[model samples]
Target: MRCQPPSTFQVYIWLKSKQSCLLCDETTDATFPICTGCETDLPWLGDQCERCALPMPMAGLTCGQCLRHPPAFSEVVVPWRYDFPIDSLVTRFKHQGKWPMGRLLAELLGQSLHYRFAEGLPRPDCLLPVPLARKRLRQRGYNQAAMLARWLGTHVNIPTDERLLLRVLETPAQQGLDAKARKQNLRKAFALADGARIKDRHFAVVDDVLTTGATAHALARLLMDAGACRVDVYCLARTPKPED
Candidate 1:
C-alpha cells in the first residue's frame, strides 16, 4: 500500500472539532489517517544514493563511502529534504510547542513509507523514537520524535515502544559536527532503556530528520548491541551533505 499523503482532511476535521485550527493543539479527535492538500508537496528521494538516500545526479544505488564502509542500520528511508515549510514546521513543533504538526508529518511519513519500503512491508515488531535527554525533554515539554512515532504507529498498526531507547549521555549538539566527529561525539550517548524489553525484536527507529546520520548511526549501534535483530531508520527528512 502506497502510504496516503498528508490530508487536509485531518486539518479540516481538527479545525471542525476545535472550531478553529490551533496548529496541532487539540488531542481530541486528533487521530487521523491521511489528509488532502499534502499530496504533492511532500517530496521524495527519487533515485537517490542508496547508502544515504541523498539525491544523486546519477542512477547508481551505492555511494562511495557506503561501499567502502557500511552503516549500522539495514536501510535508510527518507521522504523529503529538511527544508521549507517542513523546516519551519519542525522548528515550531520543537521550539514553540506546536504539536499537531507532528501528526501531520506522520501522515506524510506513512504515505512515503508505503512508496519507499514497498508493498506488503512487514511492520517492525516495535517502533521507537530516539530518546531525548532528560533535561531537553523537560525543557521542551514534549519529544517531537516520540510524538511522530506515536502517530506513525497509529496509522500503520505497529506497536510503538516509546521508551525503548535511552540517551545515556548528553553530548554537544551535532549541528556542526562532521560525520566522523559525530560518531566520536556520540560515543556511549545512547543505550536500550531496558534491554530486556527490546531483546530479540526488530525496531524501526523514527526521527524528524537525518543530517550527518551521526545520532541515528550511534543509536542503531546501541540497539543492535542491546539485541535488536535489525534497525531501520525512518525520518521525515534528510539533509544533503555539505560539499568540501
Candidate 2:
C-alpha cells in the first residue's frame, strides 16, 4: 500500500506545535520555549555551599562567610549560576519586560522546588517576592520577582503574597555595588505590610538572582525578627563570588 500525504490542516497543526528557542533560535516544541541543546548549555549550578548556594570546588561544604555569620534564611535554593545565557535571559525578562523568559525560568525553578519538597524540604506557608522600590517599579512597570513568585505559585500550588513585603526606602540600585554597599543600601529598605501575619509561619522569598546575598540577608533578617519560623530564599540563579 502507498502512504497518503497529509492534508493542509495537518501541516498547519504541525507548524503551530513548533516554537523557537529563546537563546539559539532553533525550532523547539511548544511546551518549552528553549530547545534541549540550549537548555543543556545553561550554566547549571554544581558543588555549591549548602546554605547560601555559592558555587564551590566540592559539594557538602559551607562557605566561610555563612559559618562566620549565618544568614537569617535557612537555605538558598537555586538551579543555575548567574553566568552567560542565564544572565542574559534574566536581563531581558527583568529589564526589557520579556515575560516569556521569566515564565520559562520560573517553571524550571518550580520543578526543582517540587523535587526538593518531595525530598523532605519543608513547604513554606507562603512565597514573598522581594519588594521593589516604587520609583523602580514605576519605571519598570512590573516587579520581576513578583511575577516569578506568582508563576511559581501556580506551578507548585503555593500561595504568593506580593503585598506581604514592602520596600519603604528608595535607595540607589544594587548593581555595581560591593557586598557591603549593597547591605548598606538595603538597610531600612524593607518592611512588612500593615497587619501582615508573621509569627510561626514559614516563608520563601523569591527573586530573579542571588548576587551578593545582601538583599536576601536583609529580607530574611526582617522575617526572622518578625518571628517567622523558617525563611528560605528561592531564586533562578546564584552568582559565584567575584574573587573565585
Candidate 3:
C-alpha cells in the first residue's frame, strides 16, 4: 500500500515544528519566524505622539502640529520606528516581492494590536486598506497594504474589506514631497465605493508604514465624511519627523 498524503492539519503541525527565523535563518522555537534576539533588537517605537505616533522625546504629550491642526484619524498605533532592519524588511517585502517578510511583519503587528486591545483600545468594526492606484498595482503585481490587512485580519479575527474604499485619482508618488505638497497631492484622491455603508462604523486603516500621514488624513477625512464614527491608523512602522 502507498503512504497517504499529509492532511492540511498535519502539514500545519509539521511546519510549526520545523520553523526557522526569517532574519537570522536559525531554527526558532517561537511561534513566529523571528528569534528573540532579533525581535529585541528591532527599533521599537519609544515615546511617541499620542495622535500621530511620531517619535518624541517623552511620552504622554501630543505633538504641536496635532494640537494646532488635528487630523481626521483619532489615533495611530505602530510598532517600530522606520529604521534599519525594519525599513529593510518592509522595502524587500513591498518592492522585492519577499512575501515571507511581509507575513512576519504582519504577524508581529497583529500581536501588538492584541496587546493594545487588551489595554483598553476598542477593536474596530473592520479594517480598510489604503487603496493603491491601478497603475501602481499593475506594476507591483499586488497591493502591500491590502495583503497586510488580509493577513492581519486572519490573525486578529477582524473583518478586512479591500473594496469599500477606492483610489479615484492616480496622483504622483508622495515620496520626497513636503507635508504641504503631499496634502495637495492627495486632495480628491480617495472616495468611498458606491453603496458602502460607513455610517456610524468604526474603522482601522491598515498600511505598511506611516510617514507624513497625508494619505491617512485623506482617507480618514473621506471616511468621516461618509459618517464613519471613528478612524484609527495601524501600521508596521512610522517615520520620524525630518528633523528628528
Candidate 4:
C-alpha cells in the first residue's frame, strides 16, 4: 500500500506560519518546544473544590452549596479561580476581546485537561463552547469561548462543533445580576441549533470562566434536554464562592 497520510493530530501541531506560542513569544520550527513556563502554568489545577473546581480550602472535597444540591455537569476542571491575575486575564480576554489571551487560557485548559482525562476522565465526544449572544458576537467580533474551544479541540483531538448550540434569547449580562436574577435571566436563554443531529453525544462545554454557573447550568440543561448523555465543563477559571 502507498504510505498512509499524516493523521489530523500530526497535522494539528505542525506549525503553520511560524506562529509564536501564546504567553511566551517563541518562534516555532522543527526542534524547540512551546514555552515550558506557560506549559507548567497550564498543566495543573492547584487546590480546588473537587466538585465545582473552584480554588478553595483543599480541606473540603465539595463546597456547602454543592453539598446541598449538586450541579448537572460532571466534575468541572478549572486551572485557576476567578481572582488575582486571572480576573484581569479574563476581563481583558472576554470584555476587551484580547484575542491572544484566549490561546494562552485555552492552552492551560487543554494541558490541565490532558492531565485529567489522560489519566482517564472519559473524554467527551465533542466540545461545545458556551454560545455567545449574537449581539455580543457582533460587538466583540468573536466569542472568546469559541476561540478557547478551537485550541482545546485541537489539543485533545475532539471536534469543536460551534454550530451545535445557539444562544437564542439574549439576556442581560450576568455580572450585575444577583443569584435569583441570574437564574431567571438565563432560563430559556439557549437551545440546540436547528438541524443539529446530536443524539447520544457527551459534550465538554468550554468557557473563559465559571461564575455562579447559572449560564452554564442552563446550557447543560439544554444539552441534556436535546439528548446529550452527559456534560463536562472545562473552564479557565472558576469564581470563588461569594462571601456572605
Q: Would you list the C-alpha lDDT of every candidate in the order shown?
A: 0.74, 0.93, 0.94, 0.77
lDDT of 4 by residue, 1-244 (tens): 7486756536345436565654457765422234655454543446776767766656357776778777777778787767655677678888787766766677757776888776889899999999889998999898888899998899878989998888889888888777779989988788887888667888888888888877777877777877788888888887766772
Query: Distance (Å) between predicted and true CA of 205, model 4?
Result: 0.8
Identify the runs in model 1 with alpha carbons over 4 angstroms from their true place: 1-38, 116-120
Please provide, for model 3 over 1-244, each residue's C-alpha lDDT reduced to its tens digit, 9 standing for 90 to 100.
7477656435333435657889899988898999999999999999999999999999999999899889999999899999989999999999999999999999999999999999999899999999999999999999999999999999999999999999999999988999999999999999898999999999999999899999999999999998999999999999998987
How many angstroms is residue 31 displaced in model 2 relative to the true structure, after the best TM-score fit? 3.2
Candidate achieving higher lDDT, 2 or 4: 2
Q: Which structure among the candidates has the greatest lDDT?
A: 3
Poorest 10 consecutive residues by lDDT, candidate 1 = 18-27
Shift of residue 43 alpha carbon in model 3, Å: 0.4
RMSD values, in order shown: 8.4, 7.4, 2.8, 6.0
Collision count of model 4: 0
Put down candidate 2 lDDT per residue, 90-181, tens digits, no spaces: 99999999999999999989989999999999999999999989999999999999999999999999999999999999999999999989
What lDDT does model 1 reach? 0.74
Candidate order, TM-score descending: 3, 2, 4, 1
RMSD of 3: 2.8
What TM-score should be assigned to candidate 4?
Answer: 0.81
Question: What is the model-wide C-alpha lDDT for candidate 4?
Answer: 0.77
Clash count of each predicted structure = 7, 0, 0, 0
For model 1, residues 158-197, the per-residue Cα lDDT tens digits are: 8888766778788777778888998899888887654356
By lDDT, the candidates rank as 3, 2, 4, 1
